[model samples]
Target: MAALILFSVTVSVISEKGEPAADLLRENVEALADNEYGHNIYCLGYGSLDCPLNDRKVKVITGEY
Candidate 1:
């Protein structure tokens, strides 16, 4: 299924950021695949949203720490 492939790709990207095992990756991929909304958020987080994949929008929060 398309969603399965997308979720796998998303999990790979996240795993590449750190040292993740095959089992962990599989678990994450399965979990994400089941949640369509989560998949969208995952795509957005990794800049995979839409076809062109635009940069994330910046939000300005007043006041400095």
Candidate 2:
């Protein structure tokens, strides 16, 4: 008998530069993570670490798919 084991994780990063930057960062991270882990570790979401609710600041970034 033979079996295969696979591992996967969802990553979320905090960014201060808004959704655009967060999207870029997430893309980069996903690539690096896939290489590091030898699997597709996708970044599922992103959010601002320090942005306040009413500050007209960056909001949480979510994956479209």
Candidate 3:
């Protein structure tokens, strides 16, 4: 559950950048995964095609982005 939340947050926060930066972001998120289940969760997050939980969610949740 914690890992899922973290994955969601990481996906949510990833910035729009070039391929190298995206690769780095993928690496960093993958590292945080730590297990097969987590890896699956990571894949789900990545497979969302782009950031799903974006700045609008942040703004709604915390009143900032």
Candidate 4:
């Protein structure tokens, strides 16, 4: 689930950038994905490893990008 969302975002974001920046974004998104599973790491926010649970569901909260 999460991986699916990220894959789409990665493609769209990188596609817009030049090779160098795109490469960097690819690496960052790859690091976020641990495996084939949809699982994702919780990015530390403002010195804490937490964000509102609602924030995690980007798709449901916001319309298609």
Top-scoring candidate (TM-score): 1
Q: Rate the local accuracy (lDDT) of all candidates.
A: 0.52, 0.35, 0.44, 0.50
CA RMSD of all predictions = 12.9, 19.8, 17.0, 13.1
TM-score of each: 0.30, 0.23, 0.25, 0.28
Mind giving the per-residue lDDT tens digits that candidate 3 earns over 1-65? 68658766666666333223367666766777644332222112222243223422121221122
Pairs in steric clash, model 3:
none
- Residues 1-65 of candidate 2: C-alpha lDDT, one tens digit per residue: 01111111222122332423446545765565553332332332344542222333344522322
| Model 3 / residue 33 / CA error / Å | 0.7
Predicted structure 3: lDDT: 0.44
**RMSD from true fold, candidate 1:** 12.9
Query: How would you order the candidates by lDDT, starting with the best?
Result: 1, 4, 3, 2
- Candidate 2 has its poorest 10 consecutive residues by lDDT at 1-10
- How many Å off is the CA of 58 in candidate 1? 52
Per-residue lDDT for 30 in model 2? 59
Instruction: Return the number of clashes found in candidate 1.
Output: 0
Between prediction 1 and prediction 3, the one with superior lDDT is: 1
Model 4: CA > 4 A from native: 1-7, 13-21, 35-65
Q: Considering summed lDDT, which 10 consecutive residues are worst modelled in model 3?
A: 56-65
lDDT of 4 by residue, 6-64 (tens): 77776877667853345666676677764423334343334423233334333222112
